[model samples]
Target: MRSVVGGVLSVVVVVAVVACSSPREPLPGLTASATVTTAQTPTPSPTIDYSDAELGIVFEDDQSLTGDEAEVYHWVATLETEYWRTLTTNTVSPKLSSIASPEIHVRMQQMADKNASIEGGHIGGVFRVQVRDVVVEGESARAVACLDYAGATFSDPNGSYTPEEAGFGGISRQELTLARVADKTWIVLTRTAAGEC
Candidate 1:
């Protein structure tokens, strides 16, 4: 990503549209009406061989946090990092379903579809997540964290996009909603912009 800000147009293009998913059914706490099911939510199957599935986004665990709090942070970072990777590479990840709910996945896939024509872009900077707090009741959880996307970047040969043009800036704070799936695996059900850190 040459324009880490607007200079990194690919990252800006991807991150610019990062928080743009509106689900058909309201997820747990949200009062908004979600999207329609006619939307084909793609699922990753083990049988589908992936030649370029893993983008190798790194998310480190915070030693200061533990238990469900830390795990939630991990999932948030994982999903966000993977999403960024997906956008930069312009490919859907095999682990998407494992970390993101179908609602989130659909949005990511849509961007990937748009990115199919774009060539040679990459994700830069770190997906640093700081857990502020987490409230878990039963199988559902809500979390607040700061995601440092200030240094993030994505770029293509033509410089087709820019942060200013894309309109995504400072993903410094976030509110994440999660639900428990099979095992303790938590997926990002929904997330919204929570101002800045």
Candidate 2:
């Protein structure tokens, strides 16, 4: 009987000690440490401006025109009207007009016509260019552009298709040399098609 009482008392004491030693639960707002959860808002995307003269050509968004239809037209127009016009008016040599045994006006018109069929429609792709090298001499500067052309469609709306029809379609990798005509104004004097430069 004494042994049983001692055993019972020992078990009671052990249970009390353990219960007292256990860590107490934290009060409502009081905690040992804090886990601060942060709520982050995304930053808005920037709007690209292509009309800045200082950012001309170089400021073009090379990726936006890919999936957007209207953007593609605007992109092509910027290249043909803004960039190509500068080249034809300021840097194109008279010799190039004779290279095809044709007048420069005729060749340019032909090019414009071919470009017309590709732009402003869903049958083509857009491209972006990066200026890789530039050599400035006197009033002229030769600049090279590394182009990335994609989503190009070579077929005409009239059911005619020609990938070889002089800038018709397909991503043709080449280097174009442009010269500076006026202060901060440059133009492409020569362009070698399919010539990787």
Alpha carbon lDDT at 25, candidate 1: 63
Model 1 lDDT tens row, 1-197: 44566767766677768667554565677665676678777763322111122443334334354567656656766677676677666788888988877887898889898777655654554445555577777788887766655445556775634443344456557788998875657888987777987
Global local distance difference test of model 2:
0.44
In model 2, what lDDT does residue 186 have?
46
lDDT of 1 at 137: 74
lDDT of each: 0.65, 0.44
Q: Which has the greatest lDDT?
A: 1
Candidate 2 C-alpha lDDT tens digits along 1-197: 99999999999999999988968787898878878999899865554544333322333334332223223223333333343442323333343442222333455556555555464322333334544344455654444444443423345445634434524344444444444444444444555555542
Could you tell me the C-alpha RMSD of candidate 2 in Å?
17.2
**Which segments of model 1 are wrong by more than 4 Å?**
1-63, 119-127, 160-166
Q: How close is candidate 1 to the true structure, as a TM-score?
A: 0.57
